[model samples]
Every structure is written in C-alpha cells, then in structure tokens.
Target: MKRKVFLSTTFKSLLFLLFSFIYTLLPLQAQQLYQPAEQLGELFEQVQLQSVFPDSKTFPDATPLASPDEILQAYQQQKDQPGFDLRTFVMNNFEMPPQPAADFRSDTSLTVIQHIEQLWPVLTRQPGNDAGSLIPLPNAYVVPGGRFREIYYWDSFFTMLGLQASGETELIQNMVDNFTHLINTTGHIPNGNRTYYLSRSQPPFYALMLRVLAQQKGKEILTNYAPALKKEYDFWMEGANTLNAANPAHRRVVRLPDGSILNRYWDDKPEPRPESYLEDVHLAQESGRNPEELYRHIRAAAESGWDFSSRWFSDANSLGTIHTTDIIPVDLNALLFHTEMTLAQMAEMQGNKAEAKRYEQRAKERQKALLKYAWNEADDFFYDYDFVKGTTTNIPTLAAVFPLYFCMAKRKHASAVAQKIEADFLKPGGVVTTLNRTGQQWDSPNGWAPLQWMTIQALRNYKHTRLADTIARNWTRRNIEVYQATGKLVEKYNVEDLTLEAGGGEYPNQDGFGWTNGVLLKLLTLHPELLQTTEQEAVLQR
Candidate 1:
C-alpha cells in the first residue's frame, strides 16, 4: 500500500510539471486544453464525469441526475474509492427521468403558430447545469433541437426574427444580452455555451440580431449594443493590423488581389470538435492527408455551420477531399458586410462621425471585394472563391441571395442572380442550400429555415415578388405539412426529392427546431395573404 502511494505521488509531480510546461509554451487564444489532464487523479475525475457518467445512459435519459454542486461534491468526496464507479453511484442515488418527457405537445390540431407558442414554454430554461449544457443566461432563452440545448450564435438571429413578429421583444433583448455577456466574458462568443466551443464561432450574426432589434425599436437601441457589436467586429478582424501584401491573410482576415480585406470561416484550434467527437475521430483516421490539415478543415466547416457540406470540399462528392480553410464563402462575407454597415449606423446614431466613417469605409471595401471575387459574370451569380486555387468555385448555392438581402448588389447583379435562382435553385419545396446533390444536410434535397428566410426576403427586396411569393408559399407549406404529419417542425426538409424526409448529417434529424419556428412565423406575418388552405392543400410534387 505504501509503495502504491509513493508511485501515485511521483506520477502526480510529473503531471504537474508537464501541465506547467504546456501552459507556458502554448498559450492558445481560447485557453483550450491541448491534451487531457495527465495526473491520475485529474484523469480519473474526467473519465468518471465526462466519459463514464455521460456515455453511460445515452441521451434524453442522459441529463445529469445531480445538481452541479452535488455532482462536484460527490466527485470530490468519493472519487478515490477502491474500484470506484461513479456511474453506478449516480444511478442508485439519482431520480433522473427515463427520457426528456416526449416534447410537451403531440396534437396535430394545433395551428403552426399555436405549436410555436407551446414550444416557447417547452424550450425555455432557467440557468442550470443540464446534462450537456452550462448556460448562464439570467432570463430564459430558447434552444434549438435535440443535443443543442444551449444558445447558439447564428441560429438565434433567425429565431429572433419570428420572436419580434410574435410580439416577444423582451425575450429577444434578453437573448441578445446573453450574447453580450458571452462576448464580454469570453472575448468573443463561442459556438455555444459549452466550454469546449470556445476555440471558434459560427457565422457572425451579433450585428444582425441588433439589426432586428433596431427595426422594431429605433436606431437608438444600437447605441446600447454598439460596443458589444464592435467587440464582435474586432474579433473577426483580429490580425488585420499586421496584414500586408506579403502576409495577405492571418486568422480571419484575408486580403484579396485588389488590397481589400474580407473574412473567411476559421477556427483557432487545429483539432477535432468535442461535440461531434466520434465523427471527427473516424474522419481523421480515414483521411490520407496530414491530420492537422484535416482537423483545420473540420474546424473551419464548423465555423461556417455547414459542416461536411460539398460547398467547402475540393471534390463536391467526397468528404475526404474537404478543404474549408482555403475558401472565402460568399454568405459569410455578406454577413460581415452587414456587420460593418450596422456598426457604422450605430456609430452615427451615437454622434461618433469619425468612427462611423471608418466603418462605412470598411463596408465599401468589403462590398468591392465581393463584387470582384465572388461574382461570376457568365453565370450571373456569386460563388465562393478558392483563395488557394485563385478561382471561383463551381457550385451554385442559395448564398447568392445575400448580396440582394444586404442591397450590396447592383440592380443588374440582382436581376442575374434572381434569374439563375428561378431557373435552377428553386424547387417544389423551396430553394436548396446548393445545386449540388452531395448527401450532406446543407446540400441539395435539404431546405433549412434560415436559408429560406434569407432567400425569400432577398427576392422580395430585389422586386422578384412572384418568385419570392412562390418560394415562400412552398417553403411554409412544407413546414405546415410536416407539422400536420409528424406534429413537429424539424431542422430540414426534402426540397429536391420532395417525397422523402430530409437526411444526411452526423445525427438523425431533430425537432423543436428554433430557427424553423422563427422563420415560419416571420413569413406568415409578412405575407398573411399566402395562407395554407386546409380545404385542399395541394400535394408537393417531386
């Protein structure tokens, strides 16, 4: 027994020295752990909670049975028991439900609006340490579907669009404040509330959320959110001060051939994502390329929120050929362009003319860069540029709608983009994410709520009223039909085939979809004339 104690003490000392060495040598931006804890006690503690306890019961039934305080106490007090099994201890002592009480509503008779209202109560949560979450929002916040119980970055923008139209302005403000808190605490918001998501963010939608508020409230609200939004803009422009022609790109900032700056999807960590653990690990093993390159591509795709999509892959059909870091996405830059414009307007509202002018200039530069690189003259559409290959990508996607959505495109450009979308992109259900048929959820055959909102509004803004109405009617019908059939609004729909359900992702399709509810409500409010008829809801054709 004494010999075992001596060995444990020596091992702990070695781990302490290793941990100190890593902290000193590699100070990552997010302070993410490079490797798991090495000390046996720490390692054992992690395995018990993160691995043993988590993977023990599977999700739905997997919400932690103890409060964070209680769990921590149990871990501290009895973690050193001989042949310790924390899983058994938790099971015996806790009263966790078998499954998350099958979402509160099952009545197909409820109107889509009624269904959304029901979800508001079902999805709202107070600050707590639920199984997979650690959100710190002061007021209740809505979450997306299964396994996504935390407030997500980009998803909230579209979700708030519906919230605003529903007369729930305070909830929207509360969510925005939660994001503000995250930005202030973490320097930038992580992908979600989890500690593991700190190394990256999804599309920069902080400014857009403020835009939604300003439209409902006056531009004066911008003054309150201006600093937080600027902090967000600065997060995207972190390495811009040092960028020169020779350097060209560093972190999120990318310099085009014309000496103008735009942003790209990027993640500081060159490693697998914690949420999609097994999927990433399997990808790493199968990828013949350098593991670092593969990890960066995976991380970059997460930043785009179109993980495993053909849009970022060198071979559109092959996930193994993904090269996300080398591409500057059209939608991503357009969103940032809006951010720049919003910051300028907010500064003007605050009577800061100089700051406003600076941001206005930045917006102009980004607009010019998009027209120069993303526009395809012959195709009359925007495509993501392959920065490494020095050419525009061949894929045609709904992302082209953004230039019109932001009013950044010329009338001629909007005309061409609208014509292309009408001819190829629009389908029986709605506009697909892309024309490519790659079996990723973000590719053909799958239509998501946020993209549907963006495309419909962009078309209407460009005066393609007929096309916009057609797309909106079809898309909303899908939402209503699926709700009528399954009594649930889901994450994606079958836009291409139109007969089967949407598929292709790391997990099965999910319901209680926050953005879907948001976009559907906003559309119904915008064009109340285009209501679905129960008398004879026409069958969607393939």
Candidate 2:
C-alpha cells in the first residue's frame, strides 16, 4: 500500500515538473497565440480589403508557409517596389484552406441515413499537429463543414447526437475530451478552435454534451468531467460577485432589478472579428455609433450562435441596431440553469454537499430571474429582457422554447408557449425561426436544425406529443425533400418556402452541415415513420 502511494505521488510530481519546465520554455509571445490577421497586421488588412480571396475568412484560415517574421520582412522589402504583385506574394507565402468536399459524388441509390453514415468518415477529422491559426486537438473531432474547417464549441454537441445514433461512442468521447482540453488550456472553449475566436465562446453547451455522454455511459462520466463543468460555469459567471446596484452588468453576468443574476452574451475583445473583418468595418462605418460598442454587440451576437438575428436588434428590422450586450437572453440563461443543475448533480454524486447546495441555490435564483425578466404574462411566452432599457424586448422566436427544453417553464406557461408555436411559429415545412421576414437568416422563412430539435424536444417535455411529432415529421420530411433535390444536407432550411434554398447570411447556406445531419438522424431514429419509401425513391435519379 505504501509503495503504491509513493509511486502515485512520484508520478504526479514528475508531471508537475515537466509541465512547469515546458511552460517556462515557451516565451510570452509564443504562449499568447495570434491569428493570421494579428500576425500579418497590415498585410492581412490589405489582403482582405483588396478582395484577394473574395471571402474575408479565407486569409485568416490560411496556414503560413514560413514564420510571420520572415513573411513580414519580405513584405516590407518588396511592398514599396514598383509593380509589386500582392496576390502572387500571398499565394506564395500562405497555403490556402481547403474548400469543402464539393466534388465528392454521392451514391444515388442510398437513402439519407446511408448518406449520413458515409459522410461521417468524410466529416471526421483526425488529430493533427498544430498548424497556423488552427489549434490542434489532442483527439479527433467532427467539423461542421464548408468553410467551418474547425470544431465549433456548440455544434459538436448536436453533432454527437448523430454520432450516438450511429453508435460512434468513441468519437463522441474523443470530442468531449477535446472540449475538456480546451477548457483546461484556454479557460473556456472559444467559438471554434481558431485563435481569433479566443475572445468569445458560443452557448454554454459543455454541460449538455456531458449530460449526453453520461446518459450513454452512466453517472460516472459526470464525475470524470466535474472539473470541466465547474470551470465552464465559472467562466460564464466570472463577474457575478463584482456586480452591484451601481454596476449591474459585467461581461456575461447581469444582475437584475430584483437582485437575481442572469447571463447575457458578450465577447472580451472590442475589435472587428477577424473572420468578418470587412463586413464589420463597413457596418461600423455605416452605423455612426461608437465603433467599439457596435463591434462588441456584433461579437456578442456571434456568441449567441444566432448571428445577425432580429432577436438581438433593438429595431427588429435592422442589424445595425443590434444591442445584444444589453439584453438578457432567455436561451442563454436557461442553458446556464442546466449547467448549474448538472454541476449540482455531479457535486452530489461526488459527495460534496456544500458545493452541490451552492449550485442548487444558484439554479433556483436564475430560474426566478428568468421568470421575472424574460416571461411575458400578457404574451404568454418568453422574450429577452433589455436590462439597459428595463423592459422586455418582445421579439418572438424559437428561443422561447428553451425554458421548456430545460424543463424550467411552468406547466401553464408551457401550454401557452405551445399555443403560440402552433399559432405563429409552426410552418408547412417545419417551424419558421421567427415571425418577421427580416432579411437575417435567423428570422422568418428559415428553420434551423438546432432550433427544430430544441422545439420538438421542448414540446415533448411539456407532453405536447402531437405537436412534437408534427414538427418532427415536417422537419425530417423537409430535410429528405432537400436531400433528394440537392444530394446534400445543409445548415438551415427555408421552412416557409420549401422550393427555395435557405438564404440570408454573410456567407451562402453551407452544405455538409453537422447539426442538420445530427438532428435529422436522431429525429429519424425517434420517428422512423417519417422516412417514407416514396421519399427515398425520389432521389434515385440523382
């Protein structure tokens, strides 16, 4: 027994020493990783502004063929010379990111399920050595495809749902471990693995991912990720203790009028996003608002995963009027509520009574805050609270379903929400994202896969099985019809107009979609009747 204890202690000591030595060896600049935009500085701006690659994100994702210093020195020496070719220089110095598998021909006879299964291997990225701007994971992960060449924070959770259905347990665990590594190294998982995304994180789906893994593996999986769960919760609630009446908002944490705390989406940095640099700069220039404040709001909207939605805009018609930081989002708070509840359960299982109680109390307070700030009694649905304006923003959307998704809504409220969905949100194809046809993709005429899954499950939670089944059938049918036409699954669908492709975003609607595939597969598994033989036969000519 003594020998075993001694060996364990020696092993831990060695690990500590090795880590410390490696930490010391990395210089401050090397330790603080930079994206290509920051590394190449003026050169990056020129490349983007001149439309060298057309897509602003392209240059940022490109891997440098040599060190940034060498490239910059060459630029300095050659940029001043007459007839200096910028495009040729960039092509020579950087290896452009690979485009999505646009050329991969699909087997026409295979059904959507078979296509998804085959695409799994294609979507699955193996672990690689770190490349320029790409933060390499220790374990393999599934990317959401088409310009999104990195593992996104929230997208992986939904992607795992499909993985679970496919019986790819190892891949799911590998992705979970990758997120754990991210939390340990970066304090929180960023929007994705890119260095430019370091300032912001997407919805706090880490706890939800852990819940899925635990459901499959057992409660023991929770204990294994207890530290990560706590770290994620801490990152969102970082400034809760500092918030006071005088300064009610701090970063992501917002202290309400009733003294209850909730969260809002926020990004640490105020600069224009490197991925959307040109668009952000143009918007900021056009808005005539404080450029920093506008940039932060845009970044916060990005953090919401419903980027450019009317839900974040003060004026529902205009993206320029976005005031995301001032709004306490119902979906964000519900996600945090689930995170707290998960942490409490994990703590209780670990036999830590005090920590468990602390989390429980936090969850209760947040639930109360959600009811107080977000629930609209007259409307009988939840809406985001504009804390700065001290009123409900009153933009109705699929985000209202989040409270039910977490089982946090009152039974009466759930019934009212369901009625609202049937009356306004539900559509022929599925449920439209919002009632307004504002050109933003998260608005009317569009139905995203993640929102569909959430709404269907939320309806099921409230025992609205018929509505849930209706949604499931419609959504899955729409997915099949589109697949039959295009031979591909995509990021979002035009649920209001089945004949048209989903549109409205900085980029075109992406194919090889992660969440769409995951949600559709899971829905089909739940309601296999949705996959009619007639639907499969329609794609035979492809």
State how far residue 103 of model 2 sits from its true place (Å). 3.7
Candidate 1 — which pairs collide? none
TM-score result, candidate 2: 0.94
Model 2 lDDT, residue 350, Cα: 90
lDDT digits (tens) for residues 20-76 of candidate 1: 344435333344322211112342344433554343223223334445455556767
What C-alpha lDDT do the candidate models reach, one value each?
0.75, 0.86
lDDT of 2 by residue, 1-542 (tens): 01111223234334533443454354424655656877798998888778887788998998889889899889999999999999999999998888757777777568889999888888888877457788767678899988898999889889999988887776777788778777767778899999989899999999989878777666676777787778888999998999999999999999887788899999999988999999899999999999999999999999999997999888898889999999999999999999999999988999999999999998998998898889999899999999999999999989999999999999999999999999998887899999888889899899999999999999999899999988888888889888877788999999987779889979999989899999999888777778874375455745
Candidate 1: stretches off by over 4 Å:
1-103, 128-135, 532-542
Candidate 1 yields a Cα-based lDDT of 0.75
The alpha-carbon deviation from the true structure for residue 412 of candidate 1, after best TM-score superposition, in angstroms, is 1.5
